[model samples]
Target: MTTETPTPLVDFTAAAAEARAIADAAGVVITAVDEVTAARRVNQLAERVWGPGVGTAVDLVTALAHAGGVALLAAQGTAGEPATDVGFALGFLGWSDGLHLHSHQVGVAPEHRSRGVGLALKLAQRAVCLEHGVRLMRWTFDPLLAPNAHFNLARLGASGTAFLPDFYGQMADSINAGDRSDRLEISWRLDRALPSKRPAAPQANESLVLEADSRGWPHPTGEPLGPGCAVEIPGNYSELRQLADPRAPAWRQAVGETLAGAFAAGLTVAEFRNSRYLLAAPHRP
Candidate 1:
């Protein structure tokens, strides 16, 4: 977006105010953390290995300014923590905002998540991108999340080209939970306004391939893969794969056989994105 140089120090007051407004409307609160607190969180993210720390945010803001400026977002309670938390991310289209090089950092409050706040923050970020002539904004996230998968792929229409494993190696957080830390490097191609297109017409006669795994041909067992080169695919792929398995009756009960069957019929499978399968053209030699 128009990467306006946000004040060196983000106006926590104004950001807090906007957060409060949104929270109040929803009967929740979004609070901003000071540099100290932000810094600590950043430190924790750095020292510890589960969630991102305040340092990460600091870096984002710094790079934003360097790339022309980044907007730091926070959502929490009135004073302590936000009843609803949100982050607004902005970065130069071409400028890399450090932390693996990206230009946005919008997100929602952990406790106050859902309810469409992430989308709102993203929409707002897009406005900034447009204002600044940013054509492609990028970010990274774990590939196994079903919710985020649908959000990024089905919702925002982003495309992927990279895959980084143990991107941070290992985090001491519970969210990494049981899975290995593999991340998808994706780009939100905002070069142009989004298209007013509808979902693809269902091919009733065709079976859909809901998810792919690492074992299949395209994956090629230890084939070349990395952060800057991968593609997008569905989320909750592991769970979905189990469901899609013919032996599982519940799989058909959920997505239904038609959609899943059609997908399988139409596409060639690609690499494994943390248990989920990404479809792509057969690789060129």
Candidate 2:
């Protein structure tokens, strides 16, 4: 007879508790949206973030919520005052190899950014997924934005699995109106422990596949050199876009080609640090 170790149980209650603590510290209240009124509020908040005619319709949000999807709203208010909506996250159930949640969008009011409300909403979403036996979540985001790359890869401990150029084609939103919609598809394992701190910055000796020029534009330096390589991007891509800088499209093309090639060569984005994406080769067992 042989003794075997039992697998540890997923502590979903603890996850929910921590999410609640984060929301409390951020001074925001997160609630599930199940009714038409709440769904409409979510749509309104989306419009405020992305611009008019860019948000999902109220009927779709309502339908998704009623069909066992995850739709959450974040608000802030005092004891007697009515709560003002500040953020929303929407996702639907998906299945590939196994059940998972495909997070479609997460938006925060411009005035409410940098307050940890976004992170709180994500954690709350994670808790909801784990409770429903969904251990995996997937989403896509602009790969050239340093802050978004750091938020998803470093803050959430998610892994970028693919580089998709022009993933959504042209868009009319204020944020991405004139640019290609290149995206990094990432997967988050909800059962895994969240990162306690950001990853260490890339070392000075690391080879850079992409580097910024003196004019603050991206340029491809060389092919990825397996593990311990880095890809530097603009720290203020939004500013470049706002100025209609010609270099903005150059940055987009350079980053898309570099990441797409790197992924093709079997390298993965291990971490994002120092406004760079650090690459590593997958482990073989």
Candidate 3:
């Protein structure tokens, strides 16, 4: 009798096809774009996604692509046809903690958001990373953005480990303009299964270091009293900015200080529940 070998757990081709199907269902086609023309389109998409002064330049995209970086573009149209760029993800090799892909930026056009385009782009990124033997991807996002928090932590299974206040200083981008640019640094362990959003139930009398009041203003409620605690922020930063609310700065400071203090105490963001960050020390189970 001959011994049989079991199939490998990850099937890259199947995974890529599945991601393509997802984007296809949303009227978007995901493809690898390494050419100057395509890269230029992606550059334009970056501007649309991140706002002015935040988009990656065409030349930079070309250079990164030529340097063997990941240059994935999502387009609108049927397969095998010339399509217009609607989204892009750019990343490159890194040697900080072994060879990993430091996903610099991923952006979908404003008009194309909420259609699984971002998820498709990320799934494609995971497929590419697995193909190249890269098992980790790192990125940073504004912690105040609830949708991003949900997407990164709950949907994609990434782990938030650190908070960097004023990481990029003030920016001129329309989205981030006049903001302190605090970032939540997260890591995606590609080998793990992505988890669905299962936000933990909120308990009454839980120690909330920060929370929003009746008018959607973030206020400090308590200090870190145990290994675990919660920090809350308004779920809608864009709305506050659009309305030019005077409370935006207070929200930023309150949340920033709470997160900074918790992180400084060696706590990690375990989960986001009910717009509250479940922070726990590394020693906690």
CA-only RMSD, every prediction: 11.5, 4.0, 5.4
What lDDT tens digits, residue by residue, belong to model 3 across residues 76-121? 8766877777889999998885688889889999888998989989
RMSD of 1: 11.5
Candidate 3 yields a Cα-based lDDT of 0.81
**Superposition error at 262 for model 2 (Å):** 0.9
Q: Residue 97 CA error for candidate 3 (Å)?
A: 3.5
Residue ranges of candidate 3 with Cα displaced over 4 Å: 1-14, 52-54, 79-81, 197-200, 203-206, 283-285
RMSD of 3: 5.4
Q: Which stretches of candidate 2 lie over 4 Å from their true place?
A: 1-10, 283-285
The C-alpha lDDT values of all candidates are 0.44, 0.88, 0.81
Residue pairs in clash, model 2: none
Tell me the deviation in Å of residue 1 in model 1. Answer: 36
Q: List TM-scores for all candidates, in order.
A: 0.50, 0.93, 0.88
lDDT of 1 by residue, 1-285 (tens): 688442232233433344445445554322223344443343333323225432244554444445445453444456665333344344444545422226434544455467755665554455454445554567767655657765665566665455555566755554553444566667665533333246544333322234334432122223233222233234444564444543232322322232232234443233333434345533332
Encode model 2's per-residue lDDT on 13-97: one tens digit a residue: 9789989999999999999998999999999999999999888799999999999799999999999999999999999988875
lDDT of candidate 1?
0.44
**Weakest lDDT window of 10 consecutive positions for candidate 3:** 4-13
